[model samples]
Target chain A: MRISIPVSVGIFLLLLWEMGCRAWAVPVYILPPPSEVLCTALSQYRILAYHGSVTLFEILAGLALAIAVSIPMASAMFLFPWVERALAPFLVASQAIPVFALAPVLVVWFGYGIESKVIMATVIIFFPLTVNLLEGFKSCDRRHVELFRMMGYSKYGTLKKLFWPWALPYFFAGLKVAVSVATIGAVIGEWVGAQRGLGYLMIQSNARLKTDMVFAAILWLSAIGLVLWWLAGIMSRRYAPWKDRG
Target chain B: MTLVSVEGLKKDFDGLSVLSDFSLSVDRGSFVSLIGPSGCGKSTFFDLLTGAIAPDEGRILWEGRTISDLSKKAAWMAQSDLLLPWMSALDNALLPRLSPKKSDRERAMALFCELGLEGFEDYLPYRLSGGMRQRNALARTIMFDRELILLDEPLSALDSLTRQDLQGLLVSLQRDFGKTIVMITHDVEEALVTSDFVVVLSDQPMSVRSSYELIGTKPRLRDDSYVVGLRREILDMLGGHGP
Candidate 1:
């Protein structure tokens, strides 16, 4: 029923969109019908797949870099209060500056390559992962800490046996959020200056007035986001199964 | 034979005094319960004993030696089980030793079996019942292998039946294992039944109001006339603070 309800609602919405376009005799350039978008997606599968793979690579690489950096960064921030105090403002400022505004600079510095897009995705993904993990570590129960202290657990021992396990759910929470927004950074980086990726394809298709192709590119991007989100969910369940019990 | 002795210990938090000139002595292989009014400094006393926080005045002596770090001498269990949710029951019990070998696992498994959590060793804490979780916590405390065990309202969160069951188990810690125990509890009957000595405390700026020696075998009957008499006397002394 959970699956059917949303699936049926989606089908109804698509039918309404198709009928509305036909009834209004909308210009194809202004808004192509769903059927035309689907046809374009099927006919141009190879090109879309090629560009989708590039965007996928950028998103995955960016996510990997973000995870690799954020875990240690969060640990350091937790272990040493000085690091968090020094970097907190900069972390917030990184998020405050629009990624779109920084896209062009990243392209110039990294030279319109996958490196720029991956870096962009990492910048976007870093804040949430670090903050959530830090919060998770900080959330270790005072009673548990006392227990560990009374058990003669050292600083490193407490972090490994207590804080790391405690913060895992939070890590996955940040990862899920990071995965959903991961495409934004890579795609925007591609849009600013890139010869590949779905973002570039969207810009190219829009310039030619191929609205159907633009919509098709959007569909592929959504698919990639959903897959990443689903993978994050699976990993979260596997590693932090206790979360589900609660 | 004294395992722990506190001399005129005073603790204050931001000018609010909790324990003042509090003194108590616990003998080796004895179960002692501290009962008092709500919001009393019973927990703070346990904290001082465990050396989680320092007393502003006076000192705590473990085996007659003034020690600041009591981690090596005592194991503490709070009201809540405080078990790590991510770990299974066996792993939680094995927390005292971070890196456990085959014998450690076997010892933990033996403790689980003895605690009646035999088949549930692999279960996470959330999956266990309230009583089971506390038992798991007890296993962890026992695994600490310290001479002294300090418990802060350890069975207050369980249901009445579970509370009674655990009361028996607590008595065994002193009888079978021969470990000294200091527990804080609101339940007068629990103290009467399980402890060798029951010390009553006053309200904030806690000091020993009185102490009673329960001169009888443990797991004492609730309806015994001597037990009944002592229970009423303690309750009356509490002056409406009784649980």
Candidate 2:
């Protein structure tokens, strides 16, 4: 799990891959050499970083927006119950159509601005946080809730005391999974119709048959996801230590 | 006047009756225990008494008034010792303060001292073992001046030694508070030791099998041979043939 060992293993694997492609005498257009990809990424570092920033902004903005909107939405949904009744089926139906398919339509409607990318990210990230957190909120120990009720605690008080802790572990788990999907959603939107961002770069590189550029852009995107994962890990340990995975 | 009065209690689920013609009265500050088998209606009675649900037919009066109109006057502490995992012992103990007061951290901390929970107040429930959580829960329950405390086997989930330890602590706390308590437990000796009155209940279509006043003195719960014999007798009555 440590970075040094994994980096070494990855380097060894990349060396093997680069050697195999050379030995099979495959066209450079098909399977790019790892050495060539690394050089392109270094040469184009500023350009890639600017594009990567666009995708990063979209992912984080949507993630924050989703949490702000959905946590209250989940709490309200749980308390009223009818809200969940009315919305859950439609929410599930949205996920049934893959985001990649949805992305083209979103771009067509919203044009190439960051708005489409952010919308895609919000749609992708909202469900997991809402479902897992709502489940956690509702799954509180009935006894604890009754104890509060017996003490004459109001609805708001009970939510703060009895249900909030129960929901914290669940919220963290949903956030972790949603963070990854957030990247994919942002990329999907950017891929469909965007002038900038890593996804757009990869799309353009693929069209030109510049496999190394595509691969390099992919490597940076994966690195971005890894950072999100690492941050989520730290957050779970610090804030929601009760969760098992932490 | 009785702090809690239950009369002509009856309940049925899907055509199966649990309690029939159940009746009991507890003066304020009295200790009462209900001992029974698994499917017995003692727990159901607690549920009804606490307004967790309404019995199909019954009247429960608290402090000489119907609890239906005074729902907050009774506290039911459950067997699992449910503590909020994210909160510190102090905060969990302070949870009852949500009843109406400001988050009374000082009152909760004072209780920690009184309950021997001083050094452990800031620790989370997960950091403490089962015994410690139960201890914290008892401290929490102490904050309420509710006329009646219904404990649904509040310490049942603990191991034997820990359970015994809690029984002593609980007896002392009950004596000090003088809050009317109706504890439901499968442990007959626990019933004998902790109660001014003991009611034994039978299984499904359940009702009180027998009610007895356990006035025999000096810690009859675990450390007494006579109490153990009575426990066996009660077990036998429940059809438990065991070592």
Clashes of each: 0, 0
TM-score of chain A of 1: 0.97
Proportion of native contacts in model 1?
Answer: 0.82
Clashing pairs in 2: none
DockQ for all candidate structures vs. native: 0.76, 0.62
Report per-prediction Cα RMSD to one decimal: 1.6, 2.8
Best by lDDT: 1
Instruction: Give the Å error, residue B143, model 2.
Output: 0.9
- Candidates in order, TM-scores: namely 0.96, 0.91
Q: Among all windows of ten consecutive residues in candidate 1 chain B, which has the lowest summed lDDT? A: B66-75
The segments of candidate 2 whose C-alpha lies over 4 angstroms from its true place after superposition are A1-16, B69-71, B99-104, B216-229, B241-243
What lDDT score goes with residue B200 in model 2?
A: 74
Output the worst ten-in-a-row residue range by lDDT, candidate 2 chain B. B62-71
